[model samples]
Target: MSGWSDSGWGLRMQSWGEKYNQSNLGSPDCVSSSDTISRPTLWAEPSPVVPKGADVTLRCQGQRGRNRFQLWKDGELQEERNTSWHLAEFVLREVDDWRDARSYRCRSGQGPLWSELSDPLALVVMTGDFPKPSIAVSPSPSVLAWTTVTIQCQISSQQSSPDYNFALLEAKSLQVLQLQSLSRSQPYFSLPFVRAEDTGSYGCIYYRKTPPYKGSHPSHTVKLTVSGPLPKPTLWAQPGLVVAQGTNITLWCSRPSLASSEEVTYTLLKTGTWQPLRNQNATDLWTDFSLPSVRPEDTGSYRCTYKDRTASGAQSETSEALELMVTGSLPKPSLSALPGQVVEPGKHVTLQCRQPLQPELWRATFILLKVGSLQPLQSQRPVGTSAVFPLLSVRAQDAGNYTCVYKKTFFHQVSEPSDVLEIWVTDASPKPSLSAWPVSEIASGTNVTLLCQGPPWTTRFVLHKEGSMDIIQDEAKFFLTRVTSKHSGRYSCSYQLGTNGSLWTQHSDPLQLTVKVSSNTLLITLSCVIFLLLCFLLLVCFCHQYIPRAADFRGNSFRRFFCCSCLSQDVCLSHHLEDPKEETLYTEVAKERPKESSVPIDKDVTYAHLNIKNLNERQTNPKETSTEATLYATLSLD
Candidate 1:
C-alpha cells in the first residue's frame, strides 16, 4: 500500500501484525507472530533522490540466521537474493529511467513463508526539469579562518506547496553535510567558527515530504574560502592627500611585489561603510582609482583590498587607511597676527584663525597655509572661536603671505580660506642709509626728500617717525612737500627684501629735522640789530670825556676796562687822545676822598681804564709791529 512518513527518507513500513491479520482473513502466505519470524527492517543508502544514471542500494536486516531476501516493486516480485548473514542487500544499478523512480519493499526469511515486508522506500530520481533553488551566503564568501558563515538554501514561493526538506552537501563528493526539514520557513546551514577543513564549494537541494517524493536540482555552488594571515597591500594618493576643491586626485591600491598572483581585483572602501566605492581589475600589481574634480563629500578615511584570481580565490588583508582632505567647503575664517605682522627674527608671534561661531563647527581643526607651500604649515584645534598657531624664534624663511582654514574632523568638511596676512621677519642686517635733501633743518613751506638707501635686493622701504603711530611705506625716497611743524620729528627708515618683501632689515639711525619761520620776518630781525649797535657807539663817546694820562692810568692796574679802541696815526682822534704811543685811557671817575678819604661817592662811574706797558714785547711779529695807539675805557651807571 502507498504511504507517507515525516522522516526525510520517506519510509513506509507494514508491521508483522497487519500481515498476520490479513493472512487470517484470506491470504495463506502470512501467519501468526508465534509461527512466523519477526519482520525485518529496510532502508536506502545516501538518499532516495538519486541522480540520473547513478546507482542506489537497498538493505534488509533480520534476526541472525541464514535468510532469503525478496524485493518487491509495484506490488510485483522483483529480484531476490540469499545471504548467510543477518543482512541482505539489493542494488538498482543505472537508475537512469523514469520508471526507476518508484517505491520498493523488501523482506528476509529462511522458509517459504517469508517475514513481513520491510518499510517501503520511495526512490525519487533527479529529473533535469526539477525546480532549481538558489544559494546565498552571509557576510562574505572569502573570510579569515574561524569566522562564522551562514549558507542559505532558498526556494521559490511556487515550490512551497509541499513541505520541503533541505540538504547541504559538499559539491565535490556530493556528500551530505547538513540535513533539515522545514514546514514553511526557509532553511539555512550555519558553519560556526569555520576552519580550513570547511573551506570548499558547497551546494544545496530540496525534496518534498510525501510520495512522488520529488527533489529539486542542486542550486548553484558557493565557494567558502578560508585563509590564514595575508599580506596587506599599500594605499596612497597621488598629488598628496590634501587637495583643493575641484582638483583631480588618484588613489592607488598596490599589492606586494612578492604576491603570487598577477590577475587581481581591487576594491576601494571608505571608512564607516562596508560597500566598496570602486572596483577595478588589473593585471599589474597596482591599480589606480581616479576621483576627478573631487569635492568635500569625497573626503574621508579610505582603505583598499585586493583579491587574487588564484585557484583558491584568496583575498589580501586590507591596506592601511589614507585620509583625504578637500578644502573650500565651508565659510572662510578670519586670520590675524599677534604682536604685529612684522616680527623680529628671534621673537615669537602667533597667527590666529577665527572660525565662524556655529554649533556645527565647534570641533573643527584649523590649518595654516603659506603661499607656495605644498602642505599646510601647521594645524590646531579650536579654542573658543579661534585657533592660534604660535611661531617661535621665527626666521627669514618663515616670512610669507599666510592664510588659514578650518575643517570638521568627523565629516572632513573644510572651510574657505581666510584673507592673506603678510608676515615679515626682521633681521640684523646692515641698516639702510637715511638722508634728507636740501638740508636736515629747513624753514616752513619747503619740500623735503628723505632718501633711504639699502642693498640692491630691497623691494620696499618703510618710514617711521618717533612718537607717532602712523607708518608710511613707500619707495626708497619719501617726499614731503610743503612740510609744516607737524613733520618736524626724528625719522628712521627700514628696507625689506624677497618676494612680497617679507624679510626686513634693522631701522637706520634716526635723523632730526627743524622747521623755522619763513623769510617774511627777516626785516624786523635786522632792524633790531641796528638799534643795538648805535647805542653801543654813543656810550663809548661819553666815556672818552673822563680821560686820564696813560702813565696814571697804568698805575691803576686793578681796574677793569669796559671799552677799548685802537686808532692808527693817520686817522683823526678825540682831543683827549695823547700821542699814539702814549696809549691813552678814558674812565668814569668817582670821588676817592683825595686818594685817602673813605667817604662813599654817589655819582655814577661811566668808564674804567687799564694800562699797557711794553706792548712791543707782546707783539706776535717784530717785523709786523703796529703803530696804532690803543684806548681803554670803562663805562658804568648808577
Candidate 2:
C-alpha cells in the first residue's frame, strides 16, 4: 500500500484521487458482509463546526490491512486513498468553505468491492456573520393547487453589487429547497403546481462570498397553506362493476373540455388517497385508463383524476369517488322492449329496466344504462317498479346490451349490477334509388325535381348533398323550384322502410346538379365584355410598337404628295372635303424636278429634333440607314 508525504496534504483540498492493487481489487460489486470482516468508521476531529480560516481534520479508522478508504460528503465522494495503515487522516485547513456544513460519511475496502456506507455525520461551518435577509411570498400565502407561487428572498442592502449566495430553507426540516448564487438584492424562487406538501414554514438566508463563506441568520418564518385538496376528478369504469377475475376493463375520467390541444394525463386511483394504478394521456374530455387483469385482490373502490401536464407543472385534480363491487353472483334484472322484442326499423321502441330491491329502496335512484356507453340512457328516482326509457324511432344503432341498477341517492349505496340483456333489430330492407330530373346542367330559375324511388314498402325519404349537412325532406321527390349556384353539388336520396322507425335504406348513387350562372347574369355578361375589350387593347399596344399610325400618316401627307408629284410626272392635290381650309398642295414638277428636297418645318412640330438629328447622323455614317428617313427628304440641294 502507498501513503502520501505530509507536505503534499493540503487542508484546502477538495478531492483526492487514488490507485489500488489490481490483485486485491474485487469485482465492481457490493462486498458481502456475510464474510467475517470489520467495517470502518469515519469522524471529524477537533469539532465539526469551525469558523472561516480555521483548520479541521477528518479521520478514517477501521480494521488493519484494509489498504483503501473512500470519504463522501452529502452523498458526494470527497476522496479515495490507498494506504497501508487502517486509519487515514485528511487535513482540511481553512475549514469554512464549500460544502463544509453538509453531512459526510466514509467506507473502506481493498478494491471495487466496497463496504456498506457509514451513517451520515453533519459538519457545521460557523458562517453566521452576514446580514439577515427577509422572506416574502407573492400574492399572500394561501394558494390553490396547480397555481404558481413566487417566494422572494430580499436583503436590505444599499450595495449596488450583491456578493452573496441565496438559499431558501424549510424551517421545520431545515431542508434547502432553493440555493442559488445571485448578484441581486432581491431574488425570487418560482414554485409552480405546488402540491399540498409544499405548505410549510419557510425562511430565507444569504451569505457573502469570503474565506469561510459567511452566511446570514435565517429570516422570520412564513407560513404557507395550500387551501384545497387536489381538485377531485370524475372517476368511472367502463363495462363497469369492475368484475373480479374479469379481463379487459377500462376506467374513465372526464374533465371540462378545454380547447387547448395539449394532451393531458389521467391517473386511476383505488381510493381518494391511494396511489394511481395507471396513467394515460389524451386530449378529449374522457381519458380511459386500463388496469391489469382483475383478481380477488383487485376488488376495491376505484377513482380517477386528470392531470394537466401542459400547465405550469403536471397539476391534477382528483375525481368524484366511486366504488366497484366484484362478485360472481350478479343480479338478474328483467330487460324488455315496449312494442316488442322483434320490431321493424320504423317503429318507436322503449327499453324497460327493472331491478328488485328492498322496500325502502323504492325511492332510490334507478338507472337504465346501455352496455358500452359511459352515460346512462335514463336515471330517475321517481320510478316505482321499473324505469322505462323511450328511444324514439329506434334505429339499428339503438340496439345493444342493457342493464339496470338501484342506488341510494343519499348514501350512494349501489346494488349489484344486473345481467346484460341483448336486444337487436332487423333493418335489412331494399335500398332506394335517386333520380334527378334532366341529370345534367340546369339553367338558373328553372324548377328541378329529384325523385327518390324506393320499394313499395318504404314510406319515407331523405335527400342529401355532398359537403353539406342539411337534410332536405321526408318525401320521395325533392323539388328545387329556383335553382342557383348553391344547388350545384352531388345530390343523393335515401328512403325509410317505415314511417315511425329511423332505419333508412342506403343512399342511391349521387346525381350531380350543375346550376349555371344564377342571379348574376347581367354582371357576368358585363365582365365578359370588359375582358374582351382589355384583350383588344393589349393586341393594339403589341402591334403599335412595329406599325405606323394614322396620326403619323396625316402629318406626312404633304411630303407624300410632293414625292408622288416628282415620280408621277404630274402635279396632284387633295383636300378635306368637310373642311374648306384643309388642302394638300404639290408644286408643278412634270419635267426636271429637283432630285433633293427639304421642308421648313415649324419649331412646334413634335418630330423636328428627330428630323435634324437623322439628317446629320446619316451624312456622317451613310452605310448606317437607321436614320434612313433623312434620305427621303434631302436638305434643299445641300
Candidate 3:
C-alpha cells in the first residue's frame, strides 16, 4: 500500500484533475469552464495521535455550496461526502491496525472538475507501547483566575524531532485544549488569562509529524485548580506569622468540621506566586507546612487550602490572607527604660525606643520585641525623639529581654534590631537601712559618710539623693568629702543581691544632712571667746592688787564693799558686750578717805573699775564725798 506522498497517489489525482476539467462543459454558476477549483485543507479532528481503539474524524475544508469532498488513504478513496456546508468530516473507526498506518489526504470541488489534492495528514495509531512524555506546568498547576498558565510537554532529546505535534487534553472530558505542531524551540502550550472555567485535570500526548506517525502514551494528569471555589479552609500560623529573620514557623491548613475518615491534602499559597508554595498530606483534617529559617524574600501575604484525596480531587476555597513579615531592612533602634531598668513593683515604667533620625523615618512605627515571643509586644509611632511604651503597675512577669525596631510605611521596610534591654520587676521588699556617720548635720569642709545595710546576699550598694538623677554606686559606704551646701539634702540608699542582677532591695529611709559654718569660721569664734575670758581675768587681778585698803580694814565691811563693786562691774561689762555697733569699756574708781585713818590714800597706785552707763544718756551726780569720790574713764576698741 502506498502513502499519500507516493507517486501512485500523485498520478491518480493528476488524472482526476484532467478529466474533471474536460468534463466541465456547461456550468452556469462557474466563471469559466477552464477555471480550476481551489485546493482544500485536510486535517484530523482532535489530533493525529490516537489510542489503539479510538476513532478519529477526518475533516476536509473548502468553499461553500454543495462541496464534493473525497477522503483518500494510501492513494485509494475511502469515503466521499456531498454537503452544502464549507467542510465535510469522515469518521475513521477503531484505528488499531499498525499496518494501516498511512498518510491521508482529501479534495473538494463542484463535480466533474475537482481541486488539487490537499496536504497530507498523517494518521498515528498506538500499537507499540511507547514511553509516555513527561508533562509539567509553569509557575504552578494551581493558578489564580485571570492569570496565564503554561503546560509543557517534554520528551527525550533522542525522541525530539523537528516537527513533533503536541496535544493538551482535559482529563475529564478527554477534549483537546490545544494542539500545536512544534519544533524543539517551542514545546509548551500556553493558556493566557485562564479563568475558573479552566480549572480541571489535564494531560498531554506527542506524535511524529510525518507518515506512520507513531504516538506515545498519555502523560500523568496534572490538576489545574483555580482559586475561589468550594468552601474556604481556615489558615493560621503557629508561633505567629510575623517573625524576625531566621525564625521558624508553621502554617496550618484545615477544613472546618471535616470528617475524620476523609483523606485530605493541604496546599500553602503565597500572593504573587503562581504555584503552590507547599503541599502536605494529612491523615486528619489538617496539616502543617513548616518554613524553617525564613528570609526576607519569604515575607508576603499567605493563604491555604485543603483538598480531598477522593477521585474528584475537590479542593476547598482559599483561606483569608495572613501577612508574614520578616523585619531587618532599615537600622535597629535603641531601647531604654525610664527611671531605670530595674524597677519596683507598683511603679510605672516607660520603655523608650529611639529610631534612626532619617528623613524617611518620620512617622515610622516602632515595635517592641520580646526575646521568646513571636509577635511584637507593642507598637507605636514616635511622639518625640523616641517612641515610649509605658508599663503601668508593672508586675514580676513583665521582666524579660526586649528589643526594638522601626518600620517605615514606604514599602513596609523594617529596620534591624536594637540592643536588647532587659526589664526586671520585683517586689523590692526588705528595705535596706541607711545611716550617716558622725552626724547627719555636717559642717562645710568635712567628710560625710553614708552607710547602707542590707541582706547578707547583697553585693552592691547605691545611694540616691532626693530630687537628683545622679546615681552613686559603691560597696556599702558612700562618702561625700568636703561637702558643701549643695550636698546638704535628703539621701536614700538601696542594695542589690548580685553584682549583675537587676533586682534591688527597696530604698532605705531618707537621711537629711545639714551643713553649717566652715571649719575656719568655727575656729575664729572659739578664739574670740577665749580672748574675752583672758581680759576679764586680768582686770580682776589688777583691781585686787591695786586696792591697799583691803588689808587695813579689819571688818568684813570693806571686803564686802570691794566684792560688791567687783560683782557690779561684771554686770556692766556684760551689758556693754551686747552692743554690736561699738566695743567700749568704762572704768570708775572710788577713793575712800579712809573710814579708817590707817588706810592711807595710796596716791602712787591707780584703781581700775568698770562703770555701767548708757551711751544715749549722761547724768551728773551732786552727792559726792571723799569716801565715795568717783573717777570715770572710757576705752574704745573699734
Which digits, one per residue and each the tens of the lDDT, describe model 1 over residues 503-583?
667789999978776776566777888888888777766444444455454533311232234333223233334345444
Better of 1 and 2 by TM-score: 1
Which candidate leads the pack in lDDT?
A: 1
TM-score of 2: 0.27
Tens digits of lDDT, candidate 3, 1-638: 11111211101112333322221111112212233357776656555556777887777777665478898886888888788787888987887646445677788878686878765555666555557788888879776767778788887876767655666666543444455555573477777665443556778777665556566778888877655344577787878755688999888776653211345778899888899888888866578889999887777779998776655466677898876767787777888888877667788989889977777677887877788775678878765547888889988778778887777654657777888887766563468888999899978889988888875446688888878874657578887899878888888888884444665677888888888887788889999999999998976874454333324323234444555466665653454345443223223244433355565554455445433343122345435322432343333323
Q: Which stretches of candidate 3 lie over 4 Å from their true place?
A: 1-257, 272-275, 309-322, 381-385, 409-412, 428-638
Higher-lDDT candidate of 1 and 3: 1
Clashes of each: 6, 10, 2
What are the runs in model 1 whose C-alpha is more than 4 Å off?
A: 1-234, 238-244, 254-256, 259-261, 283-285, 311-317, 340-347, 370-378, 393-401, 409-412, 422-638
Which candidate leads in TM-score?
1
lDDT for model 1, please. 0.68
